[model samples]
Target: MRDSLSLWFIVKNYRIRSVFIKNFFIILSLILLPVTGFSVGIYQLYSKTVTEEISSAHLHSLSRIRDMIDMTIREADNYSIRIASSETLATLMSPSPMHNYDLNVNVLKMSAELNMMDTMRNFVESVYVYSEQNRSVISSQMGRWDLEQFLDQGWLDSYNTNKSQRKAWTVARKAKTFQSESEEKTLITLFRLAPLLETSKLGSVIINIDTARFMNMINQTGSDYIDSVFIIGGDGTILGSNDLTLINRPISDVIPVKDIAEGKPNEPVFVYEDESKQSVSYVHSLYNDWKFVSIAPLKLYEDKAKYIRNYLYISSLFSIVVALIISLVVSWRMYMPIKQIMSVVSRPGEWLEESPPPKRVNEIKYITSSILDSYGEKRELENELRYRLSLLDRAYAIALQSQINPHFLYNTLETINWQAIRLSGGENVVSDMISSLSQLLRFSLEGEDNLVPIRVEIEHCKHYIDIQKIRYPRKVDVQWHLDEKIMNYKIPRITLQPLIENSIYHGIRPMSQEGMITISGQLEGDSIVIRVADNGVGADPDKIERINQELADKNWITANNHIGIRNVNQRIKLTFGDQYGLHMASVPGHGTTVTVRISAIQA
Candidate 1:
């Protein structure tokens, strides 16, 4: 007997220890293995990825600037061609005979046309036609000037020198405007000879483009990573730039262009350092043989790389700690089922009522017995639940049967109403009252519908008001001013009649003079509002405030007073949402208005 006991102790101890050891290593391996591998190589991978992304972003910005410049140049060339081919310029340039009045009119017309063209583009400073043969220049701003008197005759020299060039874009130069008092603005001119089909023309059409505006366009694309943007010509000259001072200067004078010149022609983008040790990104434009360059600080990229390295280190440390904690949690979760089985075996009195587990039983066999016992308990509970549900279904059916009385009452009222109308044979107050009451009963019996159309609700409300008017006999008046469009929209059924009844009982019946009641409804945004107002005896301001508070109360159903108003408010909220309901306003001796707000739901 002692040998058997010792063997049982050894087997129990070995089973527990083996389970813990096996599960600990298995969970730890699944979690820590991936974390360990990730920690070793992630830093280098992140650094290379970030660097490539930054470089690609810089290259993209350069390309955008190039496209903008190319588009602007194209627009200027198109405008130049349009002005040259205009019939006004053509008639002015022809050597046909004309009177002084016609010549004056043509010159004025050409000046107006030039002025219109100048205002059409933000970058175009001025547009003008110069007639070298006529020795007269008609500018958009300065009007007509003789060849010698023109302030910008410098272009004529180039025009005469380059006679073979039909159209050409001149380099940037300071242009003197007609208003000499104004500051001189630097501009680039596009010169197109007139009479486009002819080898030679009588005059030239020149469009002046503002260089400052070009700088503004380039500066708009600048960000923290970019320092300077430049448009450099193929001959190493800076044609346009964000820095106005650098315009028309040699590219080598501002920054090192040697590396760019040495770059392979097939490569569209390249990065290099300038004299100030700043990194510059260059993009070569195949459209115009120009280079778009953006300068950035090398320290920025290095700082970003350093940040990535530090972040990776911190993340690796955190992941290692989290992995250890997760492994512990997984081992504990796996051990819980075994622990539960032991607890069940120890206390077999709960589920195993007939045949309890033996004290020295095997754990696997005891667990199997516990599962079978629990399944038997579950089946008993399911059977009891089904029996209770059957009782509930019968109770619900009994409640449905209770609605028959209201339906019977509505049918009986309809029959009596028609009989009274037939016996009267003509317009009788008793017959009309019975008809209205019967209609009211019919509307009230429609309990299956949660919502009814506004038109139907209004008709039901009118029936109630009609009966009240007969009882009061000209002592009360009810008016309706509802919108025709909102008639098709829906509201909670039997909502408006209760408020009308409340208005007559509480507001108008106590007054000595004739009382006025107004029912108005209209759509306001996404909601519909209907107000029932009476001008008879109003409540005290404090009492009105309390009634309004009760209308807004969330637990209004439990209150005793103002049952009609509270019921309507609660129904609106339950049907639509808490955001919709009723409100009340009144003065002590004047009147009260109960307003109903509901969502604009279509039937």
Candidate 2:
């Protein structure tokens, strides 16, 4: 009888059933919507971050590779210079009593030296010198051959035709060289004409450098993420590469070599594919007019990204299932009680009121109460968490600013040292001055808050300017018009240091004659006014006005003078008030004056 009544009660309870269905759908949507959105957002952000990091890493690797190539080229140039100045080479080319002195002995000696050079340096595959005057060829490896027959008979003729106008030329061609049995031996030769004694002299010296070593150096410096390196010459030839099959191949058969040769130097280009069916490539041209390409598979990082995406999707599905299960449990618990009440009411009015006291399970009662309490607590906790996250964001910004400030100061000091050496100052004096200034500046930068007493700030600025004066003794004139009364007032540390650096770098360094910078500080009514004025090629009024506007609007976020000025201005206003900030005035060809105003803070 009770089971039948319960079934009837359950069928009659439409409100309870509707609530269960509604909550189930609501819970399902809630679980799915945010999870989907969050997963998408996270995936996009991760992808972007990964792409940027990879791009930066690739660029850094390319830069290092370029440096290595430049270094190697410089070494080759040095060798050429040494050889060109040799009396043996001169005598062989001139063939005169003042110079000749037995060509056969000198040839043997030159051959021995070249052999030793090749033995000592793995990169020097062979060394050959061609004398158009004598129509002779001398090589360390092949010995003297008919200059014409060594390469194609027409090769020397072509080289001679272009030798007068072209200072140096590099071409990729097959060369006979010893190789290991296991190694596929395809060689590309780099040939450069040593500077001739006379501009119009027909005789030229050619050095054949090992293309393998050059490619190896580039490959070592390139990012491991890159699959291969290709060295392409201005002429349509693949000079060197890790892939032996491409050696001495025409550029037209491999990639867009003609387009690159005609393109602007150092301009980076992306090639989606090439005829060789290699990976996607990013190409950069060297200063010597050679092309460097870094190639990597397009799908290298794609699988990882896809894996992450799949994991996120699976996690979202799992979360939704869990949410749905919890919703069903809660719905059943709530509806069960309503069903019991309805059953009693349907039985009899008396039973409905009296049986309301039917003992509910303690566990169920506790769960019902906890759910209501948890709903409110969860909302409150979320709000608190968001507030804390906002605070953390601000703290992160402050941390970034703190870290960047010291690094900038340190790099600027290093730049000053280099400039001092360039300006011909004694190394010992410059080192000592830099050491002392570094100690003082480090203290200032690593000290407490941004605010320091005016006296301390002035000392820091003075030490910096003193280092500059040592480098440019009679060239710089610095005038300090500081009022003693304001020395006790607090100001920002290293605030004036950048201004002094700018005065030296952008102002004094450019002028051939004398340059001057004037620094003055005084107290005006409850405010401290500090001015740094430079008498060099000053700022344009339009630029100054634009910077001022940007500072006032607080639009400067990038690292530059305008940004620094804007930041200092904004920080001052934030710490004090809008009235205390920066005011800039300049006249082109006259000078520039930067004035910083801050409320006087007692030491």
Using TM-score, give the best candidate's number: 2
Per-residue CA lDDT of model 2 for 266-380, tens digit only, reads 3333455642222333355556767666565535446668888899978887988887897778767666765554443344434423433325657544444444345447657
**Tens-digit lDDT track of model 1 for 113-214:** 776654346778778787767777888878888878888765677678665664554566666775554766777666778866656687788887777886
Distance from true location, Cα of 68 in model 2, Å: 1.5
User: Which 10 consecutive positions of candidate 2 have the poorest summed lDDT?
Assistant: 274-283
**Model 1 TM-score on a 0 to 1 scale:** 0.41
State the local distance difference test value for candidate 2.
Answer: 0.67
Stretches of model 2 off by over 4 angstroms after superposition? 1-23, 95-101, 112-120, 148-158, 177-185, 217-223, 235-237, 248-287, 297-314, 329-603
- lDDT, residue 459, model 1: 87
- Name the TM-score of candidate 2: 0.46
Report lDDT (Cα) of residue 92, candidate 1: 76
Error of 2 at 602 (Å): 99
CA lDDT, every prediction?
0.73, 0.67
List clash counts for every candidate, in order.
0, 0
